[model samples]
Target: MTHSLDPAALDQLFLQARTFNKFTAEPVGDDLLRQLYDLYKWGPTSMNTQPGRVVFVRTEEGKQKLKPALMPNNVDKTMAAPVVAIVALDTAFYEHMPTQFPANPAARDLFASNAGLSTDTATRNSSLQGAYLIMAARALGLAAGPMSGFNPTMVNEAFFPDGRWKANFLINLGWGDPSGNRPRGPRLAFEDGVVLA
Candidate 1:
């Protein structure tokens, strides 16, 4: 069996991690963002259909383009963050299934033949990848503020004008300023939220 992670590792990844509202003035470099993607991409998706796509908006110009799409509450904090990741889903992701799921060359055709199944798989897998992105950022010592308050139409028009990809959510990434953190909230117990077979 795989050994359990140490307490400190657990704390960093889950126990003590916070969804930061503000960040330090320091920038998040391209190298670290690359590393973050490298780490998170290892997470599994059904039939290896990795449908998640991300656009990292770091430049002033890009942020300006994104600004009009954001909700009023999300605008300020997102602008203040070093980088904002627009996590997206590619509806045409199945086109790559032939190579991605090589063991089953028929997979691409399977999804292509059924648009509903293709969309469902793409959405579910991309959402899972967005969660993996946050965990990967935590593992790499960055704080992530994941939010879903933007107008999808506005965001899509601004970022994915061609319409191949759709926004799943957004995450603000940076070195956190602890003073901006809210008091930790409570979670539901397993017994209340989960069911045993």
Candidate 2:
């Protein structure tokens, strides 16, 4: 049984949440990252394939490894962030369906037999999970900066050398420094973006 969340919760998760550009000296530790994962990992996926894999880059060495892969505009903030999550897609995600979706053991073959289906599922669902991560971060009083200004090929080579997983996007996580935020942008009215049944 569920009811609507209070206005403050809605504000925290959506209305007032902002994509942070700079962070304070505060560091995001491993324990908090785990809690964030535990909250968002339940956002449903097709057959519960749950193909999202996250790599939290929190050390100076890790930041250096990520630097060359970022676009010029994204470099400074990413390096300064306490943790940069490498939200990735597991192409071979179906390997776990037998265990994750035990009700239909044949679910593994359904995706494994078709490469096209597998890739499409991996991308769509992993992206969905990434969105969940941002919302989860906001709920936990953290600011998130999700970005696309990076070279996928470079990131893949640097972070996922074995080729089992591929980078989808990066999210810089920490306590936001509001001074670095850009002015708020406008959003389309609901009628402009959606169609009612």
lDDT of 1 at 188: 100
TM-score of each: 0.98, 0.98
Clashes of each: 0, 0
lDDT of 1 by residue, 1-197 (tens): 49999999999999999999999999999999999999999999999999999999999999999999999999999999999999999999999988789999899999999999999999999999999999999999999999999998899999999999999999999999999899999999999999998
What range of 10 consecutive residues in model 2 has the weakest lDDT sum? 1-10
lDDT of 2 by residue, 99-139 (tens): 99999989999999999999999999999999999999999
Clashing pairs in 1: none
Candidate 1 lowest-lDDT run of ten:
92-101
